[model samples]
Target: MRCEIPILLRCCFCFPLRYGLLVWAYLKQISSISFSTVMIIKLCHDYYRIQASGAVISSLIILLMILDIAFNVLFIISAHKKDYKKMRIFYRYSIAVLCLNVAIVGFCIAMYAYYVYVAPIMIIFIWSFMVPTLVMIIVMVFLQGYLIILVRSEFIKLKNNSQFEFVNHGADEKCTANLDFVKEIPGTV
Candidate 1:
């Protein structure tokens, strides 16, 4: 996660590496591209935001997305400062994202069922609606689930590495050895 390798670091680099690329893509597109131009890269991302704006989990999804941006920044800073301990904040939200993505998958399956029931024959209108949405949701579900697993594995690995102080006295140690302590972060929330 950091150059020259900070003292504290991720046991599984893929989590941060994946999100780093996502954050970079978000920044690059949002800064330099017009909405129309951005669509080429952000097709599914924009579709999720716009289409799900009124869905039941929209608020949570929006909150998680916004929070993810913030967390990615935090991860960058913490990684630079050699504070993997602080990165533990992602443990909860990663699971939430995974669950929400599964919910979306369920909703898409239901949508498909209704569409097939209404029209056993091919329908362009519903095809247009279902194909992209289903594809996007399915992809998100897999990605989110893998991310959840990666985050959990990283935290579990952290639990024993005393170099990061992941182990502490009188701790519950459920998921992350009860990551109940946070070293103060400079210019961080």
Candidate 2:
């Protein structure tokens, strides 16, 4: 009965349920305009004005989103089977990827802000273009490394806990057997 609760919770958190919510939210955000159309236009405009290669970045962002959606769906299904270990790994990976997406979005927003405030004619060719691009690249690389470390640490902890549980259970069984043997050896005390 005690173990059943965790299993129930795990089932509830499965991929389809979680991914369905994500798909709904994404649809809501893009209900007014097509996602692809906006993405293409934004990429082209950024490429022309800032001389930043926006197409590749934009495509990468889209691809990440698709992967996230698919993983969430898979997670929901996996959880239903009480696969907590896999669920944990899936969530950790999702979080790492989500952090990367956030960094990319932040970089884009920062660039947009710079362009809007700084006079384009004065800074566009040099500072506006090169500075943001360099900064974004550096920050993205650093953040990606950081997220990878975080995920690895989490995996290690999970593995350690499982090992500890296995050892503890074995010890308990051995102790119980010893106690039963002592009981059977009556009058030895």
Q: Per-residue lDDT for 69-92 in model 1, tens only?
A: 666566555434545475577657
What lDDT score belongs to each candidate, Candidate 1 first?
A: 0.57, 0.53
RMSD of 2: 12.7
lDDT of 1 at 121: 76
lDDT by residue (1-189, candidate 2, tens digit) is 354211111112453433433343355335323564576677766765644455667877666555655665555444345444765766577566657667766776676677768766745566666666767766756654443443344344445555654245665654334333454555755
Clashing pairs in 1: 173-177
Candidate topping lDDT: 1
Worst 10 residues of 2 by lDDT: 4-13
Off by over 4 Å in 1: 1-64, 82-84, 119-122, 163-189
